[model samples]
Target: MNVPADDITGAPAELSVAEVRTAFQAWLHAKASELGEFRNLSTDVDEIFKSLSRLQRLLYSEGWIRLGWPEEVGGLGGPLVLRAVISEELAAAGYPPPFSFGTQEVLGPAVARFATPELAAEVLPRLLRGDETWCQGFSEPGAGSDLAALRLRAVDDGDTWRLSGEKIWTSWAQYADRCVILARTGSLESAHKGITAMLLDMDTPGIEVRPLRSMNGDDEFCSLYFEDVVVPKSRTLGEAGEGWAVAMFVLSCERGAAAWQRQAWMRWRLGSLAADASDLPPHTAGEALELIHILRLMSRRTVRSLSAGEQVGAVSSFDKLMMSTAEKFLFDTVLSAIPETLLLTDNESARDWRSDYFYSRASSIYGGAAEIQRNIIAERVLGMPKD
Candidate 1:
């Protein structure tokens, strides 16, 4: 699709980060007339998610979302850093990313890296174009952080695998069109070594999704049940016993690549916080900005490593820890600095602040817990003896 004449002057695949940002800002300004209805998306999760999906289609049509992906997967093909810039610019321009942005960063790269070429070619574009949504099924009722302990059994039936088990805390699974699921293929003694990963169509029989409403009153997470959900061998992400490696890869992206987007959005949120509570003491916003900058530095390194073809590995745990810290600190300041607005006001702005502040409490628990990250750092990064 052709970019609006006023916003693009060159091929998307060749544009530098700075060039893309400048051009994209112009496009956003020009498209303001079209995007007016999508503003203030965060106030309502359902409306925001729907609007963001439409926003994804808008970005894909302009070729902005295609820059960092491979041409074979229906992308323009450029440095991974380009993808970071696109998300940053969107958040900077006052648009919350489509939910797909988070899933795309967390799962898209892993699929591109491990899925068969035909499978990647067929599904990746659907995700990119916002024609469908997907969820990760790594966490089970019994397995939250200890992903290897998951018991979602995927028994091999010669030509196809039958998945039977439950997954919990899968965000937005109820609306997903597909899922990236991890299941056991070997005996319990094998742990992670005996597991396998597959890309399963969510519409398959015996698959069910029931969204879990969080304290924020939004059904943003779900519990997924699979009862002999049949998946073809061609849908396997990698070799049957190599799911541990795939899980590792997906986790790294979730913490690192996604953090870049998170930081950019956090920076915007800080700006909003500052503006809304300008009457507060200087130290409040000062500390908040400082913490966010530290996170930006950590996440920037992760992004650069990813662009340079380097695996972030355990380092992303550190990023996640810092990310949660920044998020919690930022919102804590919001509640403290503007108590009346957050606790007393009745407008949409106040409602948004209240909701976000509550959600920030989970920053430490989601995307692997802060406690887990500490363990990883102490053992894996610091080479300390595990207790």
Candidate 2:
């Protein structure tokens, strides 16, 4: 956790963004050498979670994961872009970022913004230190695209609220210690205005988490059922009926800053494939490089705007759209240019490629569908009239 004296002196005194980036890159390179070789142990979802948790704990102990967070959350105060630099450096050094990085970027912002100060202080550090895992309980079987139509109900009972409904596509719920859940608190006629957000313990009574096996042969996503699950009123994020705003904030972070991390990984994967392939097609490398470039540029702008405290709003849909396009395009290029590596090779590297290729299909569907993003862009960004 000892930052170089030179870095401390330069920072905030005479340092520029470029200087910070350079120092951080050097620090990451040194850490990478110390961390040594990484092995892909198992493709099993549980094993992957365990491995990622261990990796997160290591990074947390090293202070890399706490760079951009507030000091109140056990972080060393720095621009949010410092965290992005960490992820980029890790990927550039051929290491997968710890899974908690995604949760921190996606959900941590919501908790910091909406949760009580005491709650943020108590729980944020646990998250930063890898003491717990969290999941988003926003999507339902019937409410993936139109989240306002979600039917999960939460009724206030003086001091607590009883929740009843199921959440589909809840990622890593089986391994999560906490969940940021959105439930209906008003009449159905209220739509988005009826919803409320809460942070719930996964171990609470009347809750069931059932893992769903994906095409990649992993159970990363799950179905969560609640039978009158009770949550304390103190767990509410923002005011009642304002869950839509909280949800929008989380989704903006997901599509904006999180997309930067995804683009970094895509760049690393492209480089790995280029190094491993012997007979790639004439245009395959060009196509893959172009896709990564486009994604990186789009994601960078989105990240910068978010870091500047601007209300990125629906403009982030562009980032989400580019991410889906780049991801699917890159993976498709890989599958076509190196079909043997994806389908026939038996080595661990090839297995990893195949698994990644399979998961890339969901890239367009998970956060929001590609079509949904385009629609948002057309209506909101382009000012197109709705049909």
Q: What is the lDDT of residue 66 in candidate 2?
A: 72
Q: How close is candidate 2 to the true structure, as a TM-score?
A: 0.94
Q: State the lDDT of candidate 2 residue by residue for 356-376, as single tens digits.
A: 999999999988898999999
lDDT of 2: 0.84
Model 1: per-residue Cα lDDT over 40-97, one tens digit each: 6656667777888899998898888888888899888878898898898888877887
Q: How far is candidate 1 from the true structure (C-alpha RMSD, Å)?
A: 2.3
Among all windows of ten consecutive residues in candidate 2, which has the lowest summed lDDT? 5-14
TM per model? Answer: 0.95, 0.94
TM-score quality measure for candidate 1: 0.95
Please give the lDDT score for candidate 1: 0.87
